[model samples]
Target: MNKQLIFFFLFVLFIIYSFSVYFSGTTYDKGISHFTTEAKLGKKLFQEKNCISCHQIYGLGGYMGPELTNIISYRDNDESIARAFLKGGTAKMPNFQLNDEEIDALISYLKYIDKAGNYPPKAYEITPYGTVNEIVTDEK
Candidate 1:
Protein backbone atom coordinates (compact mmCIF):
# COMPACT_ATOMS: atom_id res chain seq x y z
CA MET A 1 0.00 0.00 0.00
CA ASN A 2 2.85 2.44 0.85
CA LYS A 3 4.61 1.75 -2.47
CA GLN A 4 1.38 2.13 -4.42
CA LEU A 5 0.67 5.52 -2.82
CA ILE A 6 4.19 6.77 -3.65
CA PHE A 7 3.83 5.68 -7.29
CA PHE A 8 0.42 7.38 -7.56
CA PHE A 9 1.80 10.63 -6.14
CA LEU A 10 4.77 10.55 -8.54
CA PHE A 11 2.44 9.98 -11.52
CA VAL A 12 0.24 12.91 -10.50
CA LEU A 13 3.23 15.21 -10.17
CA PHE A 14 4.52 14.15 -13.56
CA ILE A 15 1.17 14.89 -15.23
CA ILE A 16 0.99 18.32 -13.61
CA TYR A 17 4.54 19.19 -14.67
CA SER A 18 3.86 18.10 -18.24
CA PHE A 19 0.65 20.11 -18.46
CA SER A 20 2.31 23.25 -17.13
CA VAL A 21 5.28 22.93 -19.43
CA TYR A 22 3.05 22.54 -22.48
CA PHE A 23 0.52 25.24 -21.61
CA SER A 24 2.74 28.04 -20.28
CA GLY A 25 3.28 30.01 -23.46
CA THR A 26 6.55 31.82 -24.15
CA THR A 27 7.02 35.59 -23.76
CA TYR A 28 8.69 36.06 -27.15
CA ASP A 29 5.45 35.62 -29.06
CA LYS A 30 4.43 39.19 -28.25
CA GLY A 31 7.71 40.65 -29.43
CA ILE A 32 7.80 38.59 -32.61
CA SER A 33 4.24 39.49 -33.48
CA HIS A 34 5.15 43.15 -33.31
CA PHE A 35 7.43 42.90 -36.35
CA THR A 36 6.13 44.87 -39.29
CA THR A 37 6.21 43.75 -42.91
CA GLU A 38 9.05 46.18 -43.64
CA ALA A 39 10.90 44.92 -40.60
CA LYS A 40 10.60 41.36 -41.86
CA LEU A 41 12.11 42.33 -45.19
CA GLY A 42 14.88 44.19 -43.41
CA LYS A 43 15.60 41.14 -41.29
CA LYS A 44 16.00 39.15 -44.49
CA LEU A 45 18.34 41.79 -45.90
CA PHE A 46 20.34 41.87 -42.70
CA GLN A 47 20.88 38.12 -42.85
CA GLU A 48 21.74 38.29 -46.55
CA LYS A 49 24.28 41.07 -45.99
CA ASN A 50 25.98 39.14 -43.21
CA CYS A 51 26.01 42.39 -41.21
CA ILE A 52 26.70 40.36 -38.10
CA SER A 53 30.27 40.01 -39.33
CA CYS A 54 30.89 43.58 -38.25
CA HIS A 55 27.86 44.69 -36.25
CA GLN A 56 26.30 43.06 -33.23
CA ILE A 57 22.68 42.96 -32.15
CA TYR A 58 22.99 42.04 -28.48
CA GLY A 59 26.73 41.95 -28.00
CA LEU A 60 26.94 38.60 -29.76
CA GLY A 61 28.63 39.61 -33.01
CA GLY A 62 32.11 40.78 -33.98
CA TYR A 63 33.73 43.69 -32.16
CA MET A 64 34.62 45.54 -35.35
CA GLY A 65 31.55 47.74 -35.03
CA PRO A 66 29.45 48.99 -32.14
CA GLU A 67 26.51 47.08 -30.72
CA LEU A 68 23.30 48.12 -32.49
CA THR A 69 20.57 46.84 -30.21
CA ASN A 70 19.46 50.28 -29.12
CA ILE A 71 20.83 52.36 -31.98
CA ILE A 72 17.48 53.84 -33.01
CA SER A 73 16.81 55.05 -29.47
CA TYR A 74 20.45 56.01 -28.86
CA ARG A 75 20.45 58.23 -31.93
CA ASP A 76 17.24 59.84 -30.69
CA ASN A 77 15.24 58.07 -33.40
CA ASP A 78 17.08 59.92 -36.15
CA GLU A 79 16.31 58.00 -39.33
CA SER A 80 18.05 60.60 -41.46
CA ILE A 81 21.47 59.94 -40.03
CA ALA A 82 21.01 56.23 -40.42
CA ARG A 83 19.77 56.70 -43.97
CA ALA A 84 22.72 58.89 -44.88
CA PHE A 85 25.16 56.43 -43.40
CA LEU A 86 23.58 53.61 -45.35
CA LYS A 87 23.62 55.64 -48.54
CA GLY A 88 27.33 56.27 -48.25
CA GLY A 89 29.71 54.22 -46.18
CA THR A 90 32.38 55.74 -43.93
CA ALA A 91 36.14 55.34 -44.26
CA LYS A 92 36.12 52.04 -42.39
CA MET A 93 32.62 50.87 -43.33
CA PRO A 94 31.89 49.63 -46.82
CA ASN A 95 28.90 50.92 -48.75
CA PHE A 96 26.46 48.16 -49.57
CA GLN A 97 24.85 50.29 -52.32
CA LEU A 98 21.43 49.79 -50.80
CA ASN A 99 18.62 51.78 -52.40
CA ASP A 100 16.21 54.10 -50.60
CA GLU A 101 13.63 51.35 -50.12
CA GLU A 102 16.24 48.97 -48.77
CA ILE A 103 17.49 51.63 -46.40
CA ASP A 104 13.96 52.22 -45.17
CA ALA A 105 13.48 48.54 -44.65
CA LEU A 106 16.72 48.29 -42.73
CA ILE A 107 15.68 51.20 -40.56
CA SER A 108 12.39 49.55 -39.86
CA TYR A 109 14.19 46.40 -38.79
CA LEU A 110 16.44 48.41 -36.51
CA LYS A 111 13.41 50.02 -34.97
CA TYR A 112 11.91 46.62 -34.26
CA ILE A 113 15.15 45.47 -32.66
CA ASP A 114 15.32 48.59 -30.54
CA LYS A 115 11.85 48.00 -29.17
CA ALA A 116 12.53 44.34 -28.46
CA GLY A 117 14.94 44.78 -25.57
CA ASN A 118 18.13 46.41 -24.36
CA TYR A 119 21.59 45.00 -24.58
CA PRO A 120 24.24 45.17 -21.83
CA PRO A 121 21.13 44.88 -19.73
CA LYS A 122 20.48 47.59 -17.16
CA ALA A 123 21.12 45.24 -14.25
CA TYR A 124 23.13 42.11 -13.70
CA GLU A 125 24.81 40.15 -10.97
CA ILE A 126 28.18 38.47 -11.07
CA THR A 127 28.09 34.92 -9.91
CA PRO A 128 30.59 33.41 -7.54
CA TYR A 129 31.91 31.34 -10.43
CA GLY A 130 32.73 34.50 -12.41
CA THR A 131 29.78 34.24 -14.76
CA VAL A 132 27.37 37.13 -15.09
CA ASN A 133 23.62 36.74 -14.84
CA GLU A 134 21.18 39.26 -16.32
CA ILE A 135 18.74 40.74 -13.82
CA VAL A 136 15.18 41.09 -15.11
CA THR A 137 12.85 43.74 -13.71
CA ASP A 138 9.22 44.62 -14.24
CA GLU A 139 9.42 47.52 -16.64
CA LYS A 140 5.85 47.56 -17.88
Candidate 2:
Protein backbone atom coordinates (compact mmCIF):
# COMPACT_ATOMS: atom_id res chain seq x y z
CA MET A 1 0.00 0.00 0.00
CA ASN A 2 2.82 2.43 0.86
CA LYS A 3 4.60 1.72 -2.43
CA GLN A 4 1.39 2.29 -4.39
CA LEU A 5 0.83 5.64 -2.62
CA ILE A 6 4.40 6.75 -3.38
CA PHE A 7 4.00 5.84 -7.05
CA PHE A 8 0.75 7.78 -7.22
CA PHE A 9 2.42 10.88 -5.71
CA LEU A 10 5.32 10.65 -8.17
CA PHE A 11 2.95 10.29 -11.11
CA VAL A 12 1.03 13.41 -10.04
CA LEU A 13 4.25 15.40 -9.66
CA PHE A 14 5.38 14.38 -13.15
CA ILE A 15 2.09 15.44 -14.68
CA ILE A 16 2.35 18.89 -13.07
CA TYR A 17 5.94 19.28 -14.22
CA SER A 18 5.03 18.42 -17.79
CA PHE A 19 2.18 20.93 -17.86
CA SER A 20 4.41 23.70 -16.51
CA VAL A 21 7.03 23.06 -19.14
CA TYR A 22 4.49 22.99 -21.95
CA PHE A 23 3.02 26.36 -20.94
CA SER A 24 6.27 28.16 -20.17
CA GLY A 25 6.20 29.78 -23.69
CA THR A 26 8.97 30.09 -26.25
CA THR A 27 11.78 32.68 -26.36
CA TYR A 28 11.76 32.87 -30.17
CA ASP A 29 9.76 35.40 -32.13
CA LYS A 30 7.18 33.31 -33.97
CA GLY A 31 6.51 36.07 -36.49
CA ILE A 32 10.16 36.14 -37.57
CA SER A 33 10.17 33.48 -40.28
CA HIS A 34 12.66 33.43 -43.16
CA PHE A 35 9.98 33.07 -45.80
CA THR A 36 11.11 35.72 -48.23
CA THR A 37 13.70 34.86 -50.88
CA GLU A 38 16.06 37.58 -49.69
CA ALA A 39 15.71 36.50 -46.08
CA LYS A 40 16.32 32.90 -47.03
CA LEU A 41 19.39 33.83 -49.05
CA GLY A 42 20.61 35.98 -46.21
CA LYS A 43 20.16 33.13 -43.76
CA LYS A 44 22.07 30.88 -46.11
CA LEU A 45 24.82 33.45 -46.44
CA PHE A 46 25.03 33.76 -42.69
CA GLN A 47 25.35 30.01 -42.33
CA GLU A 48 27.82 29.71 -45.21
CA LYS A 49 29.96 32.46 -43.68
CA ASN A 50 29.80 30.72 -40.30
CA CYS A 51 28.68 33.91 -38.55
CA ILE A 52 27.29 31.85 -35.68
CA SER A 53 30.79 30.70 -34.90
CA CYS A 54 31.45 34.21 -33.59
CA HIS A 55 28.42 36.52 -33.38
CA GLN A 56 25.16 35.64 -31.69
CA ILE A 57 21.61 36.37 -32.80
CA TYR A 58 18.97 36.27 -30.06
CA GLY A 59 21.81 35.37 -27.69
CA LEU A 60 22.12 31.76 -28.85
CA GLY A 61 25.37 31.78 -30.81
CA GLY A 62 29.04 31.59 -29.85
CA TYR A 63 30.84 34.02 -27.53
CA MET A 64 33.77 34.88 -29.82
CA GLY A 65 32.03 38.06 -31.02
CA PRO A 66 29.42 40.46 -29.69
CA GLU A 67 25.73 39.56 -29.68
CA LEU A 68 24.06 40.88 -32.88
CA THR A 69 20.48 40.90 -31.72
CA ASN A 70 20.00 44.66 -31.56
CA ILE A 71 22.89 45.69 -33.77
CA ILE A 72 20.68 47.66 -36.17
CA SER A 73 19.10 49.55 -33.30
CA TYR A 74 22.52 50.43 -31.97
CA ARG A 75 23.65 51.73 -35.38
CA ASP A 76 20.37 53.63 -35.75
CA ASN A 77 19.89 52.32 -39.34
CA ASP A 78 20.87 49.70 -41.89
CA GLU A 79 23.34 51.94 -43.73
CA SER A 80 25.77 51.79 -40.82
CA ILE A 81 25.56 48.02 -40.67
CA ALA A 82 26.08 47.84 -44.46
CA ARG A 83 29.09 50.09 -44.20
CA ALA A 84 30.57 47.96 -41.45
CA PHE A 85 30.10 44.84 -43.55
CA LEU A 86 31.57 46.56 -46.59
CA LYS A 87 34.61 47.78 -44.68
CA GLY A 88 35.11 44.32 -43.17
CA GLY A 89 35.09 43.84 -39.43
CA THR A 90 37.74 44.68 -36.88
CA ALA A 91 40.98 42.72 -36.40
CA LYS A 92 39.00 39.78 -35.08
CA MET A 93 36.44 39.86 -37.91
CA PRO A 94 37.58 39.03 -41.42
CA ASN A 95 36.40 40.69 -44.64
CA PHE A 96 33.75 38.66 -46.43
CA GLN A 97 34.07 40.40 -49.83
CA LEU A 98 30.34 40.03 -50.29
CA ASN A 99 28.78 41.75 -53.30
CA ASP A 100 26.17 44.52 -53.10
CA GLU A 101 23.25 42.09 -53.60
CA GLU A 102 24.55 39.72 -50.95
CA ILE A 103 25.05 42.63 -48.59
CA ASP A 104 21.48 43.82 -49.20
CA ALA A 105 20.06 40.36 -48.47
CA LEU A 106 22.10 40.04 -45.33
CA ILE A 107 20.94 43.45 -44.18
CA SER A 108 17.31 42.52 -44.89
CA TYR A 109 17.63 39.40 -42.78
CA LEU A 110 19.23 41.38 -39.98
CA LYS A 111 16.43 43.94 -40.07
CA TYR A 112 13.86 41.17 -39.81
CA ILE A 113 15.64 39.76 -36.80
CA ASP A 114 15.85 43.20 -35.22
CA LYS A 115 12.12 43.74 -35.68
CA ALA A 116 11.38 40.40 -34.10
CA GLY A 117 12.69 41.12 -30.61
CA ASN A 118 15.37 42.70 -28.42
CA TYR A 119 18.43 41.01 -26.98
CA PRO A 120 20.73 41.02 -23.89
CA PRO A 121 17.42 41.60 -22.08
CA LYS A 122 17.74 45.06 -20.54
CA ALA A 123 15.31 44.59 -17.62
CA TYR A 124 16.58 42.12 -15.07
CA GLU A 125 15.16 41.38 -11.65
CA ILE A 126 17.63 40.35 -9.00
CA THR A 127 16.40 38.01 -6.36
CA PRO A 128 17.57 37.93 -2.76
CA TYR A 129 19.41 34.69 -3.51
CA GLY A 130 21.41 36.37 -6.30
CA THR A 131 19.37 34.73 -9.00
CA VAL A 132 18.76 37.05 -11.97
CA ASN A 133 15.49 36.80 -13.91
CA GLU A 134 14.81 38.46 -17.30
CA ILE A 135 12.03 41.00 -17.26
CA VAL A 136 10.47 41.73 -20.65
CA THR A 137 9.51 45.37 -21.19
CA ASP A 138 8.10 47.49 -23.99
CA GLU A 139 10.70 48.95 -26.34
CA LYS A 140 10.99 52.73 -26.33
Candidate 3:
Protein backbone atom coordinates (compact mmCIF):
# COMPACT_ATOMS: atom_id res chain seq x y z
CA MET A 1 0.00 0.00 0.00
CA ASN A 2 2.80 2.43 0.91
CA LYS A 3 4.50 1.71 -2.39
CA GLN A 4 1.36 2.52 -4.31
CA LEU A 5 0.92 5.80 -2.48
CA ILE A 6 4.53 6.78 -3.18
CA PHE A 7 4.18 5.93 -6.82
CA PHE A 8 0.99 7.96 -7.06
CA PHE A 9 2.64 10.95 -5.48
CA LEU A 10 5.55 10.74 -7.90
CA PHE A 11 3.18 10.53 -10.80
CA VAL A 12 1.33 13.62 -9.66
CA LEU A 13 4.56 15.53 -9.26
CA PHE A 14 5.72 14.52 -12.69
CA ILE A 15 2.47 15.70 -14.24
CA ILE A 16 2.76 19.06 -12.52
CA TYR A 17 6.34 19.51 -13.57
CA SER A 18 5.59 18.65 -17.16
CA PHE A 19 2.70 21.11 -17.25
CA SER A 20 4.87 23.89 -15.90
CA VAL A 21 7.53 23.26 -18.49
CA TYR A 22 5.01 23.26 -21.31
CA PHE A 23 3.36 26.46 -20.18
CA SER A 24 6.64 28.27 -19.66
CA GLY A 25 7.87 27.31 -23.11
CA THR A 26 4.62 28.42 -24.72
CA THR A 27 4.84 31.78 -22.98
CA TYR A 28 8.44 32.18 -24.11
CA ASP A 29 7.68 31.64 -27.77
CA LYS A 30 4.84 34.12 -27.63
CA GLY A 31 7.04 36.67 -25.96
CA ILE A 32 9.77 36.27 -28.55
CA SER A 33 7.27 36.80 -31.36
CA HIS A 34 5.98 39.97 -29.77
CA PHE A 35 9.48 41.28 -29.20
CA THR A 36 10.32 40.48 -32.80
CA THR A 37 7.67 42.98 -33.85
CA GLU A 38 9.16 45.68 -31.68
CA ALA A 39 12.54 44.81 -33.07
CA LYS A 40 11.24 45.40 -36.56
CA LEU A 41 10.01 48.83 -35.56
CA GLY A 42 13.43 49.44 -34.09
CA LYS A 43 15.11 48.56 -37.36
CA LYS A 44 13.10 51.21 -39.16
CA LEU A 45 13.95 53.85 -36.58
CA PHE A 46 17.64 52.96 -36.74
CA GLN A 47 17.71 53.81 -40.41
CA GLU A 48 15.43 56.85 -40.25
CA LYS A 49 17.40 58.51 -37.45
CA ASN A 50 20.63 58.18 -39.39
CA CYS A 51 22.11 55.86 -36.82
CA ILE A 52 23.44 53.64 -39.57
CA SER A 53 25.42 56.57 -40.91
CA CYS A 54 27.72 56.16 -37.91
CA HIS A 55 27.10 52.65 -36.62
CA GLN A 56 26.94 49.55 -38.72
CA ILE A 57 24.94 46.39 -38.17
CA TYR A 58 25.59 43.13 -40.04
CA GLY A 59 28.19 44.47 -42.43
CA LEU A 60 26.29 47.60 -43.36
CA GLY A 61 26.39 51.29 -42.37
CA GLY A 62 29.18 53.61 -41.26
CA TYR A 63 31.82 53.00 -38.60
CA MET A 64 31.31 54.87 -35.35
CA GLY A 65 30.62 53.12 -32.09
CA PRO A 66 31.03 49.38 -32.19
CA GLU A 67 28.60 47.39 -34.28
CA LEU A 68 25.48 46.80 -32.21
CA THR A 69 24.32 43.47 -33.57
CA ASN A 70 25.07 41.74 -30.30
CA ILE A 71 24.66 44.50 -27.74
CA ILE A 72 22.46 42.39 -25.50
CA SER A 73 25.38 40.10 -24.79
CA TYR A 74 27.77 42.87 -23.80
CA ARG A 75 25.88 44.85 -21.15
CA ASP A 76 24.61 43.43 -17.88
CA ASN A 77 21.41 45.47 -17.65
CA ASP A 78 19.04 47.84 -19.41
CA GLU A 79 20.20 50.67 -17.15
CA SER A 80 23.54 50.31 -18.85
CA ILE A 81 21.79 50.52 -22.18
CA ALA A 82 19.77 53.57 -21.19
CA ARG A 83 22.82 55.28 -19.79
CA ALA A 84 24.91 54.71 -22.89
CA PHE A 85 22.18 55.92 -25.19
CA LEU A 86 21.31 59.02 -23.15
CA LYS A 87 24.83 60.13 -22.28
CA GLY A 88 26.47 58.94 -25.45
CA GLY A 89 30.16 58.26 -25.24
CA THR A 90 33.52 60.08 -25.18
CA ALA A 91 34.37 62.79 -27.69
CA LYS A 92 33.77 60.64 -30.74
CA MET A 93 30.15 59.57 -30.21
CA PRO A 94 27.81 62.45 -29.46
CA ASN A 95 24.59 61.88 -27.59
CA PHE A 96 21.60 62.06 -29.88
CA GLN A 97 19.32 63.32 -27.10
CA LEU A 98 16.70 60.70 -27.87
CA ASN A 99 13.52 60.77 -25.77
CA ASP A 100 12.19 57.71 -23.98
CA GLU A 101 10.11 56.62 -26.91
CA GLU A 102 12.97 57.11 -29.30
CA ILE A 103 15.30 55.23 -27.04
CA ASP A 104 12.88 52.35 -26.72
CA ALA A 105 12.42 52.29 -30.46
CA LEU A 106 16.13 52.43 -31.03
CA ILE A 107 16.68 49.55 -28.65
CA SER A 108 14.15 47.60 -30.61
CA TYR A 109 16.02 48.30 -33.81
CA LEU A 110 19.22 47.17 -32.15
CA LYS A 111 17.34 44.01 -31.33
CA TYR A 112 16.75 43.53 -35.02
CA ILE A 113 20.38 44.23 -35.71
CA ASP A 114 21.46 41.79 -33.04
CA LYS A 115 19.12 39.24 -34.52
CA ALA A 116 20.96 39.63 -37.78
CA GLY A 117 24.19 38.44 -36.16
CA ASN A 118 26.04 41.72 -36.56
CA TYR A 119 28.10 41.59 -33.39
CA PRO A 120 30.80 39.21 -32.24
CA PRO A 121 29.59 35.62 -32.15
CA LYS A 122 27.68 34.74 -28.97
CA ALA A 123 27.28 38.32 -27.80
CA TYR A 124 23.59 38.66 -26.77
CA GLU A 125 22.10 37.20 -23.63
CA ILE A 126 18.45 37.37 -22.56
CA THR A 127 17.59 40.02 -19.94
CA PRO A 128 14.44 40.75 -17.94
CA TYR A 129 13.32 43.81 -19.90
CA GLY A 130 10.86 42.07 -22.16
CA THR A 131 13.51 39.48 -23.03
CA VAL A 132 17.12 40.38 -23.80
CA ASN A 133 20.40 38.59 -23.08
CA GLU A 134 19.22 35.33 -24.58
CA ILE A 135 22.15 33.62 -26.25
CA VAL A 136 21.75 30.65 -28.54
CA THR A 137 25.03 28.89 -28.22
CA ASP A 138 23.93 26.22 -30.67
CA GLU A 139 22.53 28.52 -33.36
CA LYS A 140 25.25 27.42 -35.73
Candidate 4:
Protein backbone atom coordinates (compact mmCIF):
# COMPACT_ATOMS: atom_id res chain seq x y z
CA MET A 1 0.00 0.00 0.00
CA ASN A 2 2.83 2.40 0.90
CA LYS A 3 4.64 1.66 -2.38
CA GLN A 4 1.47 2.32 -4.36
CA LEU A 5 0.93 5.63 -2.56
CA ILE A 6 4.53 6.68 -3.32
CA PHE A 7 4.10 5.86 -7.00
CA PHE A 8 0.86 7.85 -7.16
CA PHE A 9 2.47 10.86 -5.54
CA LEU A 10 5.38 10.78 -7.97
CA PHE A 11 2.99 10.53 -10.90
CA VAL A 12 1.00 13.52 -9.68
CA LEU A 13 4.18 15.59 -9.32
CA PHE A 14 5.25 14.62 -12.84
CA ILE A 15 1.92 15.79 -14.27
CA ILE A 16 2.21 19.13 -12.48
CA TYR A 17 5.77 19.62 -13.75
CA SER A 18 4.70 18.84 -17.31
CA PHE A 19 1.81 21.31 -17.12
CA SER A 20 4.06 24.09 -15.82
CA VAL A 21 6.56 23.62 -18.60
CA TYR A 22 3.84 23.56 -21.22
CA PHE A 23 2.26 26.76 -19.92
CA SER A 24 5.49 28.68 -19.38
CA GLY A 25 5.93 31.64 -21.69
CA THR A 26 8.95 32.08 -23.97
CA THR A 27 11.36 34.99 -23.60
CA TYR A 28 10.78 36.16 -27.15
CA ASP A 29 8.35 39.00 -27.89
CA LYS A 30 6.51 40.42 -30.92
CA GLY A 31 9.78 41.81 -32.25
CA ILE A 32 11.27 38.38 -32.52
CA SER A 33 8.01 37.05 -33.87
CA HIS A 34 8.09 39.58 -36.70
CA PHE A 35 11.73 39.23 -37.75
CA THR A 36 12.78 41.25 -40.75
CA THR A 37 14.83 39.85 -43.62
CA GLU A 38 17.89 41.69 -42.36
CA ALA A 39 17.37 40.42 -38.84
CA LYS A 40 17.09 36.87 -40.17
CA LEU A 41 20.34 37.29 -42.07
CA GLY A 42 21.98 38.72 -39.00
CA LYS A 43 20.86 35.74 -36.94
CA LYS A 44 22.45 33.49 -39.53
CA LEU A 45 25.64 35.51 -39.49
CA PHE A 46 25.75 35.40 -35.71
CA GLN A 47 25.54 31.60 -35.83
CA GLU A 48 28.00 31.26 -38.71
CA LYS A 49 30.51 33.47 -36.90
CA ASN A 50 30.17 31.35 -33.77
CA CYS A 51 29.36 34.39 -31.62
CA ILE A 52 27.72 32.09 -29.09
CA SER A 53 31.07 30.53 -28.40
CA CYS A 54 31.99 33.68 -26.49
CA HIS A 55 29.06 36.07 -26.22
CA GLN A 56 25.72 35.24 -24.69
CA ILE A 57 22.10 36.17 -25.43
CA TYR A 58 19.55 36.08 -22.59
CA GLY A 59 22.34 34.68 -20.40
CA LEU A 60 22.27 31.30 -22.14
CA GLY A 61 25.58 31.32 -23.98
CA GLY A 62 29.25 31.22 -22.99
CA TYR A 63 30.76 33.50 -20.36
CA MET A 64 33.85 34.59 -22.31
CA GLY A 65 32.12 37.77 -23.46
CA PRO A 66 29.50 39.98 -21.83
CA GLU A 67 25.78 39.33 -22.12
CA LEU A 68 24.33 41.08 -25.21
CA THR A 69 20.67 41.07 -24.24
CA ASN A 70 20.34 44.84 -23.76
CA ILE A 71 23.64 45.97 -25.16
CA ILE A 72 22.16 48.32 -27.76
CA SER A 73 20.08 50.19 -25.16
CA TYR A 74 23.07 50.62 -22.80
CA ARG A 75 26.12 50.68 -25.11
CA ASP A 76 25.65 53.72 -27.32
CA ASN A 77 23.75 52.72 -30.45
CA ASP A 78 23.85 50.76 -33.69
CA GLU A 79 26.67 52.83 -35.14
CA SER A 80 28.96 52.12 -32.20
CA ILE A 81 28.05 48.43 -32.09
CA ALA A 82 28.89 48.22 -35.78
CA ARG A 83 32.15 50.06 -35.15
CA ALA A 84 33.12 47.47 -32.59
CA PHE A 85 32.80 44.82 -35.30
CA LEU A 86 34.87 46.89 -37.72
CA LYS A 87 37.53 47.73 -35.13
CA GLY A 88 37.75 44.17 -33.86
CA GLY A 89 37.53 43.17 -30.23
CA THR A 90 39.84 43.31 -27.25
CA ALA A 91 42.25 40.58 -26.11
CA LYS A 92 39.36 38.23 -25.37
CA MET A 93 37.21 38.66 -28.50
CA PRO A 94 38.42 38.12 -32.03
CA ASN A 95 37.40 40.30 -34.96
CA PHE A 96 35.23 38.62 -37.59
CA GLN A 97 35.93 41.34 -40.18
CA LEU A 98 32.30 41.45 -41.24
CA ASN A 99 31.38 43.68 -44.18
CA ASP A 100 29.08 46.69 -43.95
CA GLU A 101 25.98 44.73 -44.94
CA GLU A 102 26.70 41.96 -42.49
CA ILE A 103 27.29 44.49 -39.74
CA ASP A 104 24.02 46.19 -40.53
CA ALA A 105 22.13 42.93 -40.42
CA LEU A 106 23.75 42.01 -37.12
CA ILE A 107 22.72 45.35 -35.73
CA SER A 108 19.17 44.83 -36.90
CA TYR A 109 19.04 41.48 -35.15
CA LEU A 110 20.44 43.06 -32.00
CA LYS A 111 17.74 45.74 -32.11
CA TYR A 112 15.12 43.06 -32.34
CA ILE A 113 16.64 41.30 -29.34
CA ASP A 114 16.78 44.54 -27.39
CA LYS A 115 13.12 45.21 -28.06
CA ALA A 116 12.22 41.74 -26.95
CA GLY A 117 12.65 42.37 -23.20
CA ASN A 118 15.18 42.49 -20.40
CA TYR A 119 16.93 39.26 -19.58
CA PRO A 120 18.32 38.25 -16.19
CA PRO A 121 15.80 40.82 -15.09
CA LYS A 122 17.09 43.72 -13.00
CA ALA A 123 14.71 42.93 -10.12
CA TYR A 124 12.86 39.72 -9.25
CA GLU A 125 11.14 38.13 -6.30
CA ILE A 126 12.61 34.85 -5.16
CA THR A 127 10.59 32.16 -3.48
CA PRO A 128 11.86 29.96 -0.70
CA TYR A 129 11.45 27.00 -3.01
CA GLY A 130 13.98 28.52 -5.49
CA THR A 131 11.45 29.78 -8.04
CA VAL A 132 12.13 33.29 -9.31
CA ASN A 133 9.21 35.61 -10.01
CA GLU A 134 9.83 38.39 -12.48
CA ILE A 135 8.84 41.86 -11.31
CA VAL A 136 7.10 43.22 -14.37
CA THR A 137 6.69 46.98 -14.24
CA ASP A 138 5.92 49.70 -16.74
CA GLU A 139 8.97 51.26 -18.35
CA LYS A 140 9.31 54.95 -17.68
Estimate the TM-score of every prediction: 0.65, 0.60, 0.52, 0.61
Give the alpha carbon lDDT tens digit for every residue of 1-140 in model 3: 59999999999999999999999977653224435666667667666777778876666778776676566644542446644764565587777766776677667655544444535644576576767674656331
How well is each residue in 33-78 modelled by candidate 4, as lDDT tens digits?
Answer: 6378998998899899888888889888988888887778766554
Candidate 3 minimal-lDDT segment of 10 residues: 27-36
- In angstroms, give how far residue 86 of model 3 lies from its true place: 3.9
Of candidates 3 and 2, the better by lDDT: 2
Best by lDDT: 1
Q: TM-score of predicted model 2?
A: 0.60
CA RMSD of each candidate after superposition:
5.2, 7.0, 9.7, 8.3
- On lDDT, who's better, 1 or 3? 1
lDDT at 20 for candidate 1?
A: 85
User: Ranking by TM-score, best first?
Assistant: 1, 4, 2, 3
lDDT for residue 33 in candidate 3, whole number 0-100: 45
lDDT of 1 by residue, 1-140 (tens): 59999999999999999888877755435356548999999999999998889999977897787888878777877878778878998987789999989998999998888778687658889999999987764321
The residue pairs in collision within model 2 are: none
- The candidates, ranked best first by lDDT, are 1, 4, 2, 3
Candidate 2 residue runs with Cα over 4 Å from true position: 1-35, 124-140
